[model samples]
Target: MAIEINRITQVNKAALRLPNQPFKRFGTLLVTRTETGWHHQEQLSDQTFEQTFPEENYQLSAIDAAGFALGAFEGSRCVALATFEYDFHFNRYLYLADLKVDPPFRRQGIAANLLNAAEPLAKAHHKRGLCTIAQGSNLGANRFYLAAGFHIGGLNTNDYRFTSQEGDTDIYYYRDF
Candidate 1:
């Protein structure tokens, strides 16, 4: 089915989920830190790791926060979702909070379209740039952000301490307009 991208409505917000298909491809992200510095790498794998979307009001809060919640719709069903909020911390940078595409729609360019669509929305809000945070263990996500020309803005190795998810790290990236 052809994909259509647009901002999601409040009613559709509850449908926010990790794709409908099984996540069958990923690479293990290797993270290490020492006094010398930090090292991160990805070990390619054919493993299919299923993904689960944790429930949160954050996506809906995007609209409430002077931002938008973009969705990639395949007809009436949403195939992907991307939401961002404006920030004054960096002269109105668009801080992306979520970007998820259903597994069945993988490799279909829906993600790219959604991201491209977000740029104009950010610009419309007079935002200076785009920024986002991702888990260090998510190698694919890290690669996508890096390949999109975003530079590492910050890193907090203990960012996930409260969640107590072991060595999970928070990686922040940003692109200047």
Candidate 2:
């Protein structure tokens, strides 16, 4: 497929039936959270996560609110996307709420390309930075965000548990432009 990353223009019926984006799940993110600090470990395995962006059922509303959305396309099909907005509460940072690419297209820089597309949009909106959250179970995503220059912003242990092999903590990451 000839991949093209472009701005989403129309959200018609055709756009609603996007292809499913799934990723192979490998390992689990082991986290130990205490009153004083946190510890993490990754135990590799062979598993998979299939996502059709079920949340995207509400994507039109998100598209309604977003500063913009970028679609990574294989021809006319949207195989990947990054959705975000400039909420005043983020101060100078744009809040990146969703970023996903189909498993078939992983490790090809599709998400990063979408993010690269987002930064200029954020800057054009007069924003200074960007921020996002990664679930503790998604160690690959955490590594991606870190390598992309994002750092831990904060954590909410109460939202998730520490004992389970799949952690429930929200790991916030921020990157300044």
Candidate 3:
């Protein structure tokens, strides 16, 4: 497939809205704090579900305003998206806030292409690298991030505390330019 990556400007940010898609949760990554530092181990499971987040038009516009967002288009339809911004706290790396590929478009390298397209924009901003957070339970996303050159930089076991997602660790990944 010939996928074209393009910047998602305010006028076209609505293309960021992706339909809710189901996925199989094969396992979870359990992160623990050892005497030396943080570590992660996988716990396998079998489950299927779908989840969705609020992707209001206003929110997309804000993301475009704050930093940069990229969309992968097949013809005129947006099939994949990635949004990132400079990390205020880190002050060096671009924080990847969101990345999603339509279910039918999976395993097609569209996400990878979007990442590749975003790097130059981040570098243009003088960023050292790209950083992102993934739920430890999302084995697929974790593996993709790793394969995309992001390493496990940090983990927070308390990221989802006191919520339905409690016990879910947030794994932070970093890919240096």
lDDT of each structure?
Answer: 0.73, 0.72, 0.80
RMSD, one per candidate, in order: 3.9, 4.1, 2.2
Model 1's TM-score against the true structure: 0.76
Off by over 4 Å in 1: 10-40, 43-51, 57-62
- TM-score, cand. 2 vs. native: 0.76
lDDT of 3 by residue, 100-161 (tens): 88888999888888888888898998998888899998887887888899888788888799
Judging by lDDT against the true structure, name the best candidate: 3
Question: Distance (Å) between predicted and true CA of 16, model 3?
Answer: 2.4
What's the TM-score of each model vs. the native? 0.76, 0.76, 0.87
Candidate with top TM-score is 3
Which residue pairs clash within candidate 3?
none
The total number of steric clashes, by the backbone 3 Å criterion, in model 3 comes to 0
lDDT of 1 by residue, 74-110 (tens): 7788878887778736556788877878776777777
Task: Output the worst ten-in-a-row residue range by lDDT, candidate 3.
Answer: 49-58
TM-score-based ranking, best first?
Answer: 3, 1, 2
Give the Cα error of residue 14 in candidate 3, in Å.
3.2
Candidate 1 local Cα displacement, residue 149, angstroms: 2.7
